[model samples]
Target: QFDRKSQEYRALKRYWKLIQQDSRKLSDKRFYRPMFRMHLTNKEILEKLLSYSDELRQHYELYQFLLFHFQEKNSDHFFSLIEQEIATVNPIFQTVFKTFLKDKDKVLNAMELPYSNAKLEATNNLIKV
Candidate 1:
């Protein structure tokens, strides 16, 4: 069992490296193909039991929105998207969505803050080091 897990971990790591390489390509399609392949691979691993790819795609969309479209006005839309995706038939995704929902207030508060605390966190980490 341990060996099987280790093998799976290594395979995923190599696949991620391939995806990262494609991410550096000039064409959007180049990056997309590997991501799509990875999604398919994930689905195969689960024996096509559920639409895990859709869940992953939705998560990616949410991530992109958070990274690029995070604004006070978009907060409601963000939460709505999360809720919509959470309603899907996937226990794993549902659990993850519930955790995010529980922390919605904190996430929204941080998004509304004018300044980021990333620099502060980095300085604190440096001090600890």
Candidate 2:
């Protein structure tokens, strides 16, 4: 029985790792909408898995904001949104907000740049070959 339980645990761990990989892929434009739709359908499961954490919910909101509305012109609003999401009660969220505040100028400068790192990733792949 112990051996069988251990095997099941290992299988679950492997499955979770695969899910993480697929979740990362959702950042790609082609996968974003479909994965987001699936996530809405599985909202209850996701909420439970995220442990009903308010910090995680705030982070998810920020992520969605960036994913959909990111542009040079919106940089000010982005930082403002980050400021609004900073929670006084959560040390982790507070630290993250502090870091962002500290590097605000640098981040704003990068946002104004015309180029994106998406193409740079392709160049990196070519260099690795």
Candidate 3:
């Protein structure tokens, strides 16, 4: 309905060029596919992206999702998300995440979850009951 017009917007338009370069892309078939070739240091670059602004903190989830599909060794992106999500953690969160990360195979287990899906599911089940 509306449009953006400004110098920052113009410069930021550049990120759109390679935005699709993210290792994860959706195929025409609506399935997921991973990219194999990526320039080195991409991981560091993605990490640096988070360092830019606190307002962008909300995007950490998207960064991790992309890394899972597109990156094999971009530790920067992975660690950056961890640092952002955990940096200001309270004592309860700190202890819970410390234990959660102990097992990497439990992928659905989330350390930074603000809303527990389990609780949501339980609420739905209660309504059904």
What does candidate 3's lDDT look like per residue over 24-60, in tens digits?
4422232221221333344433333444545443444
TM-score of each: 0.51, 0.46, 0.23
lDDT of each: 0.54, 0.54, 0.45
Off by over 4 Å in 1: 1-12, 15-73
Angstrom error of the Cα, residue 92, model 3: value is 30
lDDT of 2 at 54: 61
Q: What is the TM-score ranking, best to worst? A: 1, 2, 3
- Better candidate by lDDT, 2 or 3: 2
The residue-by-residue lDDT of candidate 2 on 12-127, one tens digit each, is 33333332332333432223223224433233334433443465555555666754444435887777777876764367757877887899887777777766688889999999
> Each candidate's root-mean-square deviation in Å?
7.6, 8.1, 12.2
Point out the worst 10-residue segment of candidate 3 by lDDT.
Answer: 27-36
Ranking by lDDT: 2, 1, 3
Question: lDDT score of model 3?
Answer: 0.45
Highest-lDDT candidate = 2
- Give model 2's TM-score versus the native structure: 0.46
Lowest-lDDT window of 10 residues in candidate 1? 19-28
